[model samples]
Target chain A: MVEKKGLSYWLSHAGLILGVIVIGFPIWLAFVASTVTQSEIVSPPMPLLPGGEFITNYKEALFSGINAPVALMLLNSTIMALGIALGKIFISLLSAFAIVYFRFPGRQLFFWMIFLTLMLPIEVRIVPSYGVVAQFGMLNSYSGLIFPLIASATATFLFRQFFLTIPNELTEAARVDGAGPVRFFFDIILPMSKTNIAALFVILFIYGWNQFLWPLLITTDPSMNTIVMGIKQMFPSGDDNANWPVIMATSLLAMVPPVLIVIFMQKFFVRGLIESEK
Target chain B: MRRTVIFKGWKLPILLLLPQLTITALFFFYPAGQAIWESLFIPDPFGLKSQFVGTGNFEFLLSDRYYRNSFRTTAVFSISVTFLSMGIALYLAVLADRLIKGAGIYSSLLIWPYAVAPAIAGVLWLFMFNTRVGVVSWYIGLLGYDWNHVLNQGEAMGLVVLASSWGRISYNFLFFLAGLQAIPKSVIEAAAIDGAKFWRRFRTIVIPLLSPITFFLLVVNIVYAFFETFGVIHTITSGGPQQATTTLVYKVFSDGFVGQDLGSSAAQSVILLFVVGLLTVIQFKFIERKVHY
Candidate 1:
């Protein structure tokens, strides 16, 4: 490729810089608002820079929010995110292992059943699904928050795709070494699947952390509210009295963990995203 | 794609598969079947006795003015978000692809937005455009336009669309950049050697090669806008200002949860089931073609 150092190179840099600024401007404003007073944000043309009330606002949000304490919401979000990620990965790994390695009766039927889960997202079946959850007495429980959302087959399919790529010789070699299927899975397969597992974990963590509608429906209690849904609850019913600073602070707190995961585990995040979608 | 070497015991596999299957049966299939069953009948106002009116709910939904308008709104919203997000992402990707250095920084900056939840994205945008203290709305007001999404239908739609597309740009950008990078440099250089300018080379060579990814993104984005934007619409507009922004998913939640119209909501859910099935089939079909490319 020819190297161009003149106008075009500068033009590309300029364009990308502008794009970054436009993309990042909203979060920057949110940060500034989080640091300022409610009056500053409520009055026209809020200040663009950070203010002195950063600690004050975040403290208020964390200790005692309008509907529920932001601290509790954050904790709820953490538990839900970790539960969904770990639970989905565990089940998907087991199911993918079973489907890929076994040739039992009804295998294909089970595989298709799992695959069909992809077509029916919770949004489509909100009413009946809610009723089912209520029937099981899972409402307001973490199980309610996590289990319904985990039935999807994205992770299962991802693991299945990965397990297919493993050579058959590995399985044969393990059998020759007098290892049972369970032993072989524990000794060889799980160790080999570390990268895929990590990658999927990254993507699944974000997916779980960012979930909104499901959590919104099941958790009627303020204490059970995830930060993402809890933010909306902070808004006054009639309007014009939104607690901007604390809401903004809580918003930033809501974004921090998932955003940090994406930044730090970026390579895995990208690989997992592309692979899962494929 | 099954492995040749296999596990022998049916019992072990069944045992392993039980958790997922149980969850799927209990959560996915049962609720889905219930939705279909409930869709066929109209429950009277009292919860005690329900008369079975086969397909009455579906019939009413298909004819209801608001339901039809919601379908249209969903179509318009999905198309707008898909195109808007994809177009901006493609533009940024092209620029990033042209850069010989520092692409990683721009990518790292841009990609984090994907982690922001759609609900949070809505809140952030709503803050910026809030009529009273929203900086952008204030600026618009200074420009002599009353930027009120509360009363204005078009502005409400525009705001929600923008909020929905904002976070999605990062996902599309990452894919587009990967697609751009996957294009062999030799092909582009060869086109360049044939006296093609940048725009011409991009048009004749780059765009064609990028079609598979573009198509994949299109399907995924439409699915996203259809189902996932519920959070965005919920937070920002709540399908507000006279139902101008009420999408199909929003309508399902509003009708079922808020209005307690179980029969009608079940019918809407059944309808969405077919819509999603159709989209998934289209995606699989395109992916089959994509393999040959």
Candidate 2:
């Protein structure tokens, strides 16, 4: 409506449509590859449309993949995703509640310490972080997979930002009503943070699910692999023919949960992403 | 950062912060400190002892031809990936902003790629460019080119860049769309009344207004390509046919994990630390400015 009856509008729509198709074509082709037979995929120029082997390919991949079964990896991925999301949210909420509602010695110190973690992503500190985890005898455990990734400054920062926007009167009224700090937090802050918590849950869940290097390093056992990392394991060892159909099937499976979250919870995800950056 | 209306218990506040602080100390600070300390020590082959090296590892890496090339490789890789992804996303966002309906539909269709892990994104693109079986590779072959990323360093770098950029498009699109929608309709309408055509208005008014977001994204994307693309590089190039695709992050992983050169890897990690610290500061500076808006 900004410009009425213009060819530009049609062109805009056409460009967007083309963008969508281009954005989507790779995955669509991957999905098509997943449904086809391996022979068809290996032969070159695989069919663009769906094939008849979808069920068998998915079945084989899920039941028994190249190294470990996809089903097991899926379970590991679920645990990691849930563990990171809930763990980050719970701890972040507590930290934010303390920083916002309590005045104590070393509060600023603690805040800066947390802020420091924001710059230190796992990629930069992989060697030493791996050493720390290994020294703790935590390698190959679920805690190893989850705990190191849980100290997310962004989540704490986002929670702190959200809590800062809460009205002072709410805290004052809670104190006036003879509520201790704990009670006030339980009855007031927790309930108020429901939407924020949900938004963060969606974002953190995806972040956790999509982690690659940490899980690859920590989980030496193939059975312990998260599906995201496990997909790489499914590739052929050498120049041999990769089980493209099965690998493609696992790729789609590795993506489905997080993609569903982003698509279905688009509003929360968008809000969380923007707010977290702020 | 402190709230004026606050609870008064030091014990409870300390208790509340304990978990985060503990994990930070154990996983974050301690590791980071170890990285710095370990950068000064080179271990023996038998793992018996680490000899103290005062900046020897850094000197070695700085002089090494491959290490120097990795810096160049990373520079080109990150710049290409950041600009290509942002450019496409901005184009799509502008188009989406113009449409009154189906914007949501188009966004949903387009953005699911964001949730796909970088490794998975690599796999998807690798399959399409797999010389033996790839449909795209076959198409390129028909165009009189032998498209093989396996033996070709340039093709390998381009493939990883494409994979990394492809997944990032949705992220940039979402932000760009938000930024586009945030632009005041009144300013654009005023420009239209001034007889500025669509491209001119977009070029001048919309882009300048979008600069904050663009700057923020540039820093973010550089950080992303610097660190977050380990998976893409790992799955696809594995630092290459001739180490042509080895970014610093990939080099750190391969050297530390594969080569088990803790001293050099720790040295690289420390370098990456400064890079991230710089990016974090730039990002925060922009966020501060954005708050003023």
Candidate 3:
């Protein structure tokens, strides 16, 4: 029995090691491809280690005059991401507080309506949504990009779930001390649910930063484009002479923010998931 | 007293709902309604002449071989991607759950793919699969299978699916890993005491308990497969190889934006909306009930 158990454990360990390799290979390849020259990448048996052309490749990618500067694109993506994150978090907190703390008429109906939007995939609405943005004269503007995505259903839902788990006694005590609804929310509720807010912040920031489709449709001008769009523009459609080293470098540049965000907030992200389940 | 209390209670919700309502109305509702209206009319490119076609666009779409092919391709794309990625993600999640060390390293590395923007990810994959310079192509040549995603429909579809799944697995893996960890250890211990084999214990106990997470992941994955693949598909394939890779959303973008057939594009959008809406409702009605939670 002991021998059989040891054998099974060894098999599971082997399976896990193989699974990790499969998952990790693409990421390793991405890093390797970023460092090597375009020619080295396509050669027979592909280079297995990092090459010395990293600086040249990066400079070529950054200075490719075909589109907006990489620095400007990164700045644009950061501004857009921060704007959307702030809007989503603020709206979500207020709404979630109202839903949880107040005994509102038709509250259930409103909640369900928002929840329904959660299931409505953006694909179904892209064409009409584009028309709406165009009609409002928001097509090329940052406001156009930020406004539509600000009131995130997922953030609101997650916040509501978090708020519900908070003890009503705390809020009641604050109310007893003559605190208004706004005061109670700002002072007590928001502070207590800081972890949840942080978690949602990270998630929404990543989503906004990585957004591509709507940004692609709305912004035709290179200056207004986000990093994701900037990356797409780097490799012009069907151009055989497109610089691979530059493409790889530009792609690696685009990856920096989200990767940093993930690494920094991972602990909170996991905690947020665990808390939401509760 | 009751009326006053009700009014007081309702004010907060009303206030909170205002921003969401405005955004949804303008961005979600109005556009959706406009698309439906536009689908019924034929409008010229300059937005000048307009004539009511009244389901003519639908008829055209229904009969068109290209639209028919897109529908077939979309089904194949969504189903295969969702199942393939979900299966792999679940397997990895379960294995990760059992391990006591290096879990964070594995999780972080696996999720790095998720951090890569879809456009960038597509570009990276495109490089790796390039005919002359691609690592995948070099290996494929070595293996004796002439493969070029740009020229072959099946190859294009495969690349899209592979890329799409690569982007998705990280997010799905997180949810599945959390779900696995949430399952009570006591139940497993009891099963072990009853002399149940590993496969039997997992099949009868863990699988059933993980249904809620599985169902949520399935719905989310389906939605992603439907909409989120557009960017990558556009970047990598542009619905190419004779429109072999064009899913419904890709078709909508092309028809409306590129082809300048606003009415047909609107019609296609409405069809997509209906399909997604139906699936969503079915998911809630049927799958939600099956969830253990």
Clashing pairs in 3: A42-B133
Tens digits of per-residue lDDT, candidate 1, B167-219, equal: 99999999999999999999999888888999899899999999989999999
Ranked by DockQ, the better of candidates 1 and 2 is 1
TM-score of chain A of 3: 0.87
Task: Please provide, for model 3 over A126-214, each residue's C-alpha lDDT reduced to its tens digit, 9 standing for 90 to 100.
Answer: 77777778888998899888877764377787787677666656666786788877777778887898877788777778878988887
Ranking by DockQ: 1, 2, 3
**lDDT digits (tens) for residues B17-90 of candidate 3:** 78776776666667777888999999976799889999999999999999999999898999888998899889
Chain B TM-scores, listed for every candidate in order, come to: 0.98, 0.97, 0.90
Mind giving the per-residue lDDT tens digits that candidate 2 earns over A16-93?
989988889999999999998988988878999999999999999999888999999999999999999999998999
Q: What TM-score does model 2 achieve against the real structure?
A: 0.98
Candidate rank order under TM-score: 1, 2, 3
Per-residue alpha-carbon lDDT of candidate 2 for residues B16-98, written as tens digits (9 for 90 to 100): 99999999899999999999999999999987999998999999999999999999999999999999999999999999999
TM-score to native of every candidate shown: 0.99, 0.98, 0.91
What is the iRMSD in Å for candidate 1? 1.0
Clashing pairs in model 2, backbone N/Cα/C closer than 3 A: none
Clashing pairs in 1: none
Q: Which portions of model 3 miss their true places by more than 4 Å?
A: A1-5, A42-45, A63-65, A100-116, A271-278, B1-16, B286-292
